[model samples]
Target: MSDALVILGAAGIVIPVFARFRITPVIGFILVGLLVGPYGLGRMVYNHEWLTWVTITDPERLAPFAEFGIVLLLFTIGLELSFNRLWTMRKLVFGLGALELLVISTLLGASLSMLGQYWTGALGLGLALALSSTALVLPIAGTHTPVGRAALSMLLFEDIAIVPIIFILGALAPYADAEGLDGLFDTLWLGAVVVIGMMVIGRFALPRLFAQAAQTKSPELFLAASLLVVIGASLATGVVGLSPIVGALVAGLLIAETEYHSEVEGIMEPFKGLALGIFLITVGMGIDLTMIWANLGTITAAVVGVLLLKAVVTGVLLRLMGARRSTATETGILMASPSETTLIVLAAATDALLIQPGTAQFWQIVTAIGLTITPLLAMLGRNLGRRVEPVPEIEEPESGEPPVIIVGCGRVGRLVAQMLTRHGKPYIAVDSDADMIETCKREGYRAVFGNAARMDALDKLGVDRAPAVILTMDEPVLAQRITRKLRAAYPHLPIIARARDSLHAAELYRAGASTAVPETLESSLQLSEAVLVDLGVPMGPVIASIHEKRDEYRERIREGGALEHKPKLRTSTAESAAVQAG
Candidate 1:
């Protein structure tokens, strides 16, 4: 109970404090672990009894929970991906990812052998260091951008290869045993059978199970079912001598194929986060500061050497595979560090007698340090990528018309693009939806697929050079966020945003939107105009009155948003004037 209090306290302090300063909570949690782990405050608890209340007296007890955190992390990652997306990335996963692991492992292993270690031990070390942290890297890069996609491909392959790697390590054990190879083959066959069975059964069973849970109309039951599925899948794989995370990931993929995925994801989000935090904390607890201090020079050299080699190798492979130089550089650097799985492989090597316990401990410390610096490495990679590729190439329309950027390719955005076309203005639409992009392309519309919420995507779309940006997505919060981000980044860029209502319009105005067109306001004005026209009012007078009313309402909205009215000439104003004159 005291330990639980300590963990909760750490979370309460770490999340808000780090978030307030715009820092990642990963670092904060790790720092908290270092502070309260047995080697830190717990070290003094024996002499000072009061310290026992705050410190984690037995870090080993937290291991199960930490492992579960990793399971949940993989599960959530699976939820974000579909089978088609995975299949599309097969080349990257198998070709680039496989080559990267093999090359790094071979190079690191040969280097270790040259330094006088046994061939088996060196091989174990090489394979262990070749792995990169899926937990740390994925959340930071996300599976959206070029860097993120490249990283995910490699990480996915790594996850798949982990079982084989462990079995190979066992085969390398000094013990004279043909059964080791036999066991490896047996496990592989069993794992394959189990995985296929789960896929076939889960495809048919999951939707019905979730439906029953949904029918209960109980969130607690839904959550319970989600947990049950994750746990059951994890246990099934673990029982079959495969990585439990493999099962968790498969379960997530299965759930993702169903309609309840979003709800399942939402309900499991908090648990996943807390579990990942626990995993990170365990990583920190493993760090023995005194040991690191004693072996500082050697550990630093090893970490640097490993990072440099992995980064260069991974970057070259990506470049060879036809990735952008910037993407290659960023992904390589982002994936340079050894993974959380490095600890697992190291422990496995030690258990198999392929490496000594002391050696395993040393490498574990290095892995912890590497994980701690992952976020910093990510920031560096991003900055370097920006420097390398200062200006992104923009895809322009064939007509060479001035580019008007439409952030969504939805109904409103399509109408806006059509109007722009009629006015002889060239426009490009960007949407996150692949289907929408495909439809737009089929209709001969210049549309690109990307999440505009990300600044990098906007930059790639030439947002800086565009005449104006139109936010047509129905998400009010997202629209406002994009408006604020764009306004801050490009102070002079005109931002026109769609709002749900007058109140939302006012909010958008405050968020720096140049114009916030509220659907409710426009629909009301159209209705009023129609009623007046049907009641026998002159067309010219009614049109003029409607224009006058729209302007009045816009000014009022601007006032409500606490902004001074700034009159600006608009194309609509000129059209209204022409109508009034006629």
Candidate 2:
């Protein structure tokens, strides 16, 4: 299929850049798509009409793939939403998220209406203004700062709000010029109906479905069930006059409390990645460089306006919510990019006939422009982050000794600490997790309670004297943030981070980590080999051969650097295992 070929071509370009640049592959995909799209260099070879024709490129047919990207992406987000985590920031996630959506929406709407734009367009723009790029934010979250996670939580909250926003946009369609309480209530009712119906169905069917799937004990079957839950629930929501993505999100929420949650997520991970890849390429294909150039003033105005508003709002909210000054500012700057959700709102407006083609296209051009400048913005964030005041130093009490400060007392961190302890190495453990710190204390390990990325925590852990800071947070993004902070503050303190995967490891390296260990994969491979040997395969030669190939592969990967091999993850051993098990 031409659609498949397009995606492949885009991936071919993006994969290399992702490996070398430490940039999000989604950005690369978009760039590739733009170059090959009708609005850019591709227009020289094929016109828009040809690209859209079902007999030719069939662009419309890929809409569902784009839609799937949204649904699964949201679904993946929902899986991270636990009651405990929500309660940790009930005030922020609920209050701040709500305030952000309401305040920003109102301001943008009013601004657009004052500019002589139609109320429908104003409403669409209002919703669009509230969104930040999840794709962009995720890679940053991999940086591992408390600010990054806090920013991410806020973005997640915004994502959740998009469901209602879409409904509101749909209601605006029938009476294009009207703004009334009745219309608002009508949209709310539709949203309520969809939510209620899903809650009922999900509460009843999801458990039973997952329970049945578990009996099969086949990862393929589990994956099938996961995809069904996402696509089926999303489609069902679409039938009820809501965005299918919202439906999938609700579905994920419904199953969030279930025992099968982890299993479902594991099965869906690869599909989510592939779907995301396709979506990025599709988004890239839509970028109109000529239009962006022609309307530079308007596009620049829109981008600057949105970024400034979001930055101010986020900074004020975080400060008000008791976050540190550095955290407040970083959170704001890090989340200012317009991403897929913004465009999704714009596209939905077009579908509802709420915005004219020209207006919709205008917003699209602005969005693409914003996306185009995101990498530069990220570089700014990284550069600015290094300038933050360093933590005050203390003399090294243990001179010339290899000191390790394990930031998290979680499973991984504790294990790393214990390993060092067994080797008679001096180390200290710090954790924000109260229970973890208490457990470590009871176990006779030197531990303290404080946010590891916080200056106070680093000082408490004696970071200035530490020769190596071992950050083993459960979250990779959190680890990356700490790594970056440590690099900036304690330049000589070597940071050895634990990455969730190779992609994550590379990001950590970019964040200035001296070393990274993919513990999960390392353990998983060894375990899998053991299992294979138990199942009657010759383990000795097979594993040795596999290790030899793996070494060659990693050597090549290192030669290519981080950006080059980023998109070709499919060709890696990790991807092979995915095919075998997932």
Candidate 3:
């Protein structure tokens, strides 16, 4: 209970405090763990008994929760991916991901062997260090951009390879028998069966299960059902001698296929975040400051050696695989660190007697340091990538027409695109929704998949070259943010945004949107126009009066927002008027 209190208190303090400084909360959690864990303040408790109340006396008790945090992380990753999307990246997953793991492990192992370790011990170390931190890397890179996609492909392959890597470590044990290999073969078949069974049964069962939960209109019950599925799936895989995360991932994939995935994702997000914090905290607790200080020279050399080897190997492979230089460089750096899973592999190596306990402890400390600095590595990679290629090398449109860029592909965005098409104006749409992008493509619209919330995606779309940009997503905050970024980057580029109401319109205008079209105002104007036309007003005069009212409301909104200048009208609107006049 004291331990739980300590963790909760740390989260309460760490998250907001770090966020205020615009820093990642990950560093804060790790720092809190370092401060409060048994090796830190807990060390003073023997002399100062009162310290026991505040510091974590039992780090072991938090292990299960921390592991569950990883499980939830995998679960969410599964939710973000569908079977089709996974299949689409099969070449990157199996080819690049496989080669990356094997090459890095082999090179590192050979180096360790030359340094006087036995081949078995070196191999164990090599494999352990080859893995990258999916838990840390994915959230930072996201699964959207070229860098994120590349990272996700490699990480997904690594996750899938964990069981096999462990099996190999056990097989390499000096006293290992045929029984261990037999068990592995049994696990392989059993895992396969379990996965297929879950897919078949989950497809039939999950929708009905969630439907029953949704009918209750109870958030608590919904959460209970979500947890049950994740736990049950995780246990199934664990029982079959596979990783519990496999089960969690399968559970998430199943839920994702159902209509309730979004709701499930939304409800489960807070739990996933808290659990992940516990995992990060546990990582911090593992760092033995005294041990690190004593072996600082050897540990530093090992960390730097592993980081460089992994980064170089991964980057070259990505380049050969046809990734852009910037993407390859960024992804290589981002994935250079050893993973949270590396610690697990280290534990396995120690248990199998492949590596000494002392050696495992040394490397575990190194892994912790690697995890702690992942965010810094990411920032470094991003800046370096920008320096390497100031502008992303995006492919130009085939038509040779300068396309108007649409930042969303939703209903309003689609309507805007239709009008552009009707006027023979070239345009392209970008959206974060994969399904929406596919739909747009099938309907003969030029669409790209990307998260417009990030400027990288916009830059890749050649936003600077585009004649105009439109923001049509319903998210007010996101729209405003993108508008601010676009305005700052391209001061003269016209930005038209959809607003929920007059207030939202004002906010978007203040955020640098050239024009903010409020749905409420448009609906009101349409209603007034209909009433006048039905009462026998001439159609031409009614249409002119509607446009006049819209302009009037737009002026009022801009004035209310305290804007000093009335921005020029959109170029597209002027062009349309010119064509009509001609």
Candidate 4:
């Protein structure tokens, strides 16, 4: 068979599944690269020989495309970053990041340096350990809350820090080389100039470029513009002596400022998904199961020790920075995985010959093994959440009767809570949005910021003690989720949910909410008819008219069957019967 066809066949087979396996393709690609190269099924395309060879023989030819994948990945990262968000996240990103970087690096570096590894090696180890896997964590984060934002920002800070670490590693090259300092300085200076220069350029020029592109209102052109910005920034970063990932990140940040940020992200998502698929698969394929088994004891010990250290350190930092205990713990768990980017740095160092190839390979293999252990650690965090008692307690004011606990503090939730409050009924509000929680608190109301889905948050809000739950979030799906969680945890707890319409309310009721108020339709209609009757309209006719209307809607929605364990209403109103059927 011809060499060209062989490589083309391999590329076709591999690239198609790249998106399917997600980040695992990076591992697949590496393994496939190894297999196709001299190591596995040695189909040596060129014997260190031909110029025009397709795959292995054409390293220079393949380099740009491989580099493009990295560029795309960074660009996605940059696009997600927002300066306003970062400003709000100063504590988590800067304060927690610094504490994590300094403490983890110092402790690990000190331990390794004491054990006779090169000080530089120890420093690198520390840095790598301090950095959590963005690929691993971000997907888990997806689009949650303050936690997701915090995780992303911390990852950003770590990615940015890599530029300087590259220079440091570069500096550690043989001192005997007279030009070593000059080389390090040049790299550092080049990186600074490029990053700062790009920020200036991105702030000024890129927005206009994106605006011009967006003016066409073509998804294709918008996609093209996003691609151009990402690739251009990435190439620029590469030119200025940094990884293409940095350029991609810078590109993302710049584009995030554009009017078309969401549109751009939507357009670029497929590319990001493709790149990430390859990245994850590559990670999975590089499992190094044998090495992982060999160092099982050390890896296990290191994982535990590092996790403990991180949890304690992160928790302390969070508490010190005024974060709630639950927030701090969630942060620790999310940040536990040692980042894949660390391996990238290790690879770069090896490529530059600043560190032995073995050093990079060892950490890479260790990291791969470490990734395997993350799920277990996350589980442990879940099971062992809030093990230590909170120092400054945030308990609700004790009441005689069980309080109506609202799971969200949005407009609807606040209104419901205020209604209850005005009636001299006790209630507590919980929301994941920090600003919403703050606003609720300032209004002289009881509210806590937390994830309603999480047990810790529910527990904090005295869910165990509460007799009822109010799901007042605008999103009916979210309301249903909160209802289900509350029902499962407290089966007897009556759940009243606000739904957009009767259909949504019915769905919520089926999802275990005792009563779902479709404000726009059923509830409003019932209340309006009652108010009209009170204003001396014919009461008997109005009551009979609405009663019939309510029954039909009830019958249509009640097919899901009885979800009630216990009766929620004492009065046999038509709404009560419908809720019971639900």
- Compute each candidate's TM-score over C-alphas: 0.77, 0.64, 0.76, 0.62
Q: After superposition, how far is residue 249 of candidate 1 from its true place, in Å?
A: 0.9
Tens digit of per-residue lDDT, candidate 3, span 309-334? 99899999999999988899999999
TM-score of 3: 0.76
Those runs of model 4 whose alpha carbons end farther than 4 Å from true positions after fitting are 1-77, 87-95, 142-153, 175-178, 305-311, 348-359, 389-415, 426-582
How many clashes (backbone N, Cα, C below 3 Å) per candidate? 0, 14, 0, 23
Candidate 1 achieves a global lDDT of 0.89
Clashes in predicted model 3: 0
Model 1, position 292: C-alpha lDDT score: 93
Model 2 clashes, total count = 14
Q: How well is each residue in 191-240 modelled by candidate 4, as lDDT tens digits?
A: 78988998887788977887788788787887777778777877787786
For TM-score, candidate 1 versus 3, the one ahead is 1
Best model per lDDT: 1
Residue clash pairs of candidate 1: none
How large is the C-alpha RMSD of every model relative to the true structure? 9.0, 13.4, 8.9, 10.7
- Greater lDDT among 1 and 3 belongs to 1
